[model samples]
Target: MGNIVKSLESSLATGNLQKMSETMDQFEKQFVNMEVQAEFMESAMAGSTSLSTPEGE
Candidate 1:
């Protein structure tokens, strides 16, 4: 996340849409990894506690 933020800041400083797009891809990758981890944690916790999420999600 910090890496993405720094990358985005640099891209903004240079006004580089290409770099910003690359940073967005990095951010998407981070989100994917996070979701995977969250799912794993929820799966692991399911046996002990009910997994919770916001309504409609």
Candidate 2:
């Protein structure tokens, strides 16, 4: 993510629209992957907690 932002800044400074667009595409893909992983982790944590609870409480 940091590398992508740095590349985007470099592209903007050099006025290279193509490189900027490619960097943005890469950032978008990385962001979506992080979101999916977060959701899966949250679901796994919830499942584990539910299974560890005492029967009457």
Candidate 3:
């Protein structure tokens, strides 16, 4: 009986570790995508304003 309980506990611990690893991987991917989007918006705005400026007043 004691050995059976130990086996079950080990299995549960392994599963939990796997889930934590997968969650962190997904979080990293999402963070990188957000950073790219922010950079694109900043450059686009700068270009737009520069184009609209009047020439030689």
Measured against the true structure, the TM-scores of the candidates, in listed sequence, are: 0.77, 0.94, 0.64
* TM-score-sorted candidate list, best first: 2, 1, 3
Residue 51's lDDT within candidate 2 is 93
Q: Rate the local accuracy (lDDT) of all candidates.
A: 0.90, 0.97, 0.70
Give the alpha carbon lDDT tens digit for every residue of 1-57 in model 2: 999989999999999999999999999999999999999999999999999998897
Q: Which candidate achieves the best lDDT against the true structure? A: 2
- Highest TM-score: give the candidate number: 2
Name the candidate, 1 or 2, with the larger lDDT value. Answer: 2
Runs of candidate 1 exceeding 4 Å displacement: 49-57
Per-residue lDDT tens digits of candidate 1, residues 1-57? Answer: 998999999999999999999999989999999999999998889845544654566
Report the CA-based lDDT of candidate 1 relative to the real structure.
Answer: 0.90
- Measure candidate 2: CA RMSD: 0.7
Model 3 lDDT tens row, 1-57: 344355546656777766555555566776788899999999999899889988874
Rank by lDDT (best first): 2, 1, 3
